[model samples]
Target: LWRVCFRRKLRPRQVTGDTTYGTVENIVAVEDAGIQAFFPLPDFDRRTPFFGKGTFTYDPGADAYRCPQGQLLPRRKTKYTEEEVLYQADSTTCNTCPVKAECTKSDHGRMVHRSFYADYLDKVQGYHETEAYQKAMRKRKVWVEPLFAEAKEWHGLRRLRLRGLLNANIQGLLIAAGQNLKRLLAAGRRHAPCGSLLALLREPWRLSAVYG
Candidate 1:
């Protein structure tokens, strides 16, 4: 469906036992907000079975690719994609290729996905490699995550307040308000009684029960 409008208001994406609703939120504080808006990558290590082009082996010093026989395999041909650069081996040579059975089942020959953006992703990975994001994400554990265990384990509250949309909305608002109060009390921030409500609207997780 086409979106008639975009509202940053906290809309329920999922309701966990009248406790939480994960929301898509935006904060103006981030500098490169647009590019960093999306998920980073599908995986962590990112080294694929098909080596990315420009990807070096354990021994590039050896003139050729160390084939299964550990012999030097010549670079037969290179190819291009809409996305990135690529390289390939000779299909005719692959027919008699000793490691053909182990290397690939493809009668065509083994092909590798070459990404020009691999270095970009590597930098992003290196950012995560540091102690930073982990440290920041830890703040999420304080309230909402433990609140969930309390709701689920102690109260047996595993679902929403009511079936119809109106009832669900009411339940959500109440939970958000409760969470706001919890944060204000816990932090001892300089805030008046209504100030907590304002802060809840500013930060998303404040409206949800758990830190996660």
Candidate 2:
């Protein structure tokens, strides 16, 4: 969506979404295209330390991570995809540490997998900590989430009526049309219901036909 909008020169001020779209790839794509993305970071893995990644600091000069117990986790090797580098602590050193039991359950010691886009992700994490991001999140909650709620709860859009992908897309657009008509009616009731209803019925395609 952002890419299409960008190509059309309809540059948005910012992009916002829930956790599912708040990924490192999406954030980097938006930021690279010169747009600010407002989103919260996903929850950390439960298997990780309760202190989370905050307890593991990255050292760029050494290309290593400093564990909470002060052990260095050096870069071991790259994954098959080459998009991620695995950093591992020495098993001997980790096993001897007094806090070993609390630190890692793996006998090979704790490992941190760093992505090629880790730096971009770190910057986005900083954005997530800001008040502006929180405010945008609130706005998203009000504007975005309610549309789905109304579609599902009132418009019988809880389940897809069609099977194939193209058919499903058609169904989705129909539901969106219904929602737009509902909003138009609600607004029309205030001043010009008869004219608005006639205009809507007469030119429904006017609302959906434009490509750019």
Candidate 3:
């Protein structure tokens, strides 16, 4: 979609989606395309009882994370498959620290992960504070989510009746077309303006891809 928009000189200023599309790779790809990524990161530490990942501050000059206890967690290893670098505090230091109980239960030490694309993720995280991000998310909730809900509830989209990618794609396309036609007729009944409706016609693929 970004490429299509770029080629047509209709590049979107921001791309919004739910957390399912918030992987590090996707966030980097969207931002690298020069569009803002308005999505929440999958915060694995959100429910952690101990100090969360956010409690550790990164020091770029030293290439390490400073723990709340003022200990520097130096880079330990890089897991390429996971696309993240591990930083860990010294086990002996952690075991002896006064706040060790609040930090981690690991005998090895407190650990923090820095993604290969941490910079991009960090930038996207900052977008949470922007009004533009809030507006985009609001639009997504209103304009995008209901289409899926309606499909699942009324259009037999709860489960696939067909098998295989080709057949599934065909089924999805048909369902989206039916939904579009229904909306088109409803718009016609209300005598809606043509401008946005025509834009919708031009981007039918978006409906198929999104709902599918």
Clashes of each: 6, 0, 0
Best by TM-score: 3
Q: Residue by residue across 67-143, what tens digits does model 2's lDDT show?
A: 98888999999996868989999999988888877777878878888888888778877888788888888866776
lDDT of 3: 0.84
Best by lDDT: 3
Question: What ranges in model 1 sit over 4 Å off?
Answer: 1-40, 44-82, 96-98, 137-175, 182-212
| Clashing residue pairs for model 2 | none
lDDT (C-alpha) at residue 22 in model 2: 83
- Cα deviation in Å at residue 90, candidate 1? 2.3
Instruction: For residue 13, give model 3's deviation from the true position in Å.
Output: 2.0
TM-score of each: 0.39, 0.80, 0.83
What is candidate 3's lDDT per residue for 105-139, written digit by digit as tens? 99899999888998998899999999999988887
Question: Against the hidden true structure, what lDDT does model 2 obtain?
Answer: 0.77
Distance from true position, residue 43, model 1, in Å?
Answer: 2.8
lDDT of 1 by residue, 72-169 (tens): 44444445534544434566777787656756676765555444454444444454554554443355467546765655564434677588977765
RMSD of 3: 3.8
Per-model lDDT: 0.45, 0.77, 0.84
Q: What TM-score does candidate 3 reach?
A: 0.83
Residue 72 CA displacement from its true place in model 2, Å: 1.1
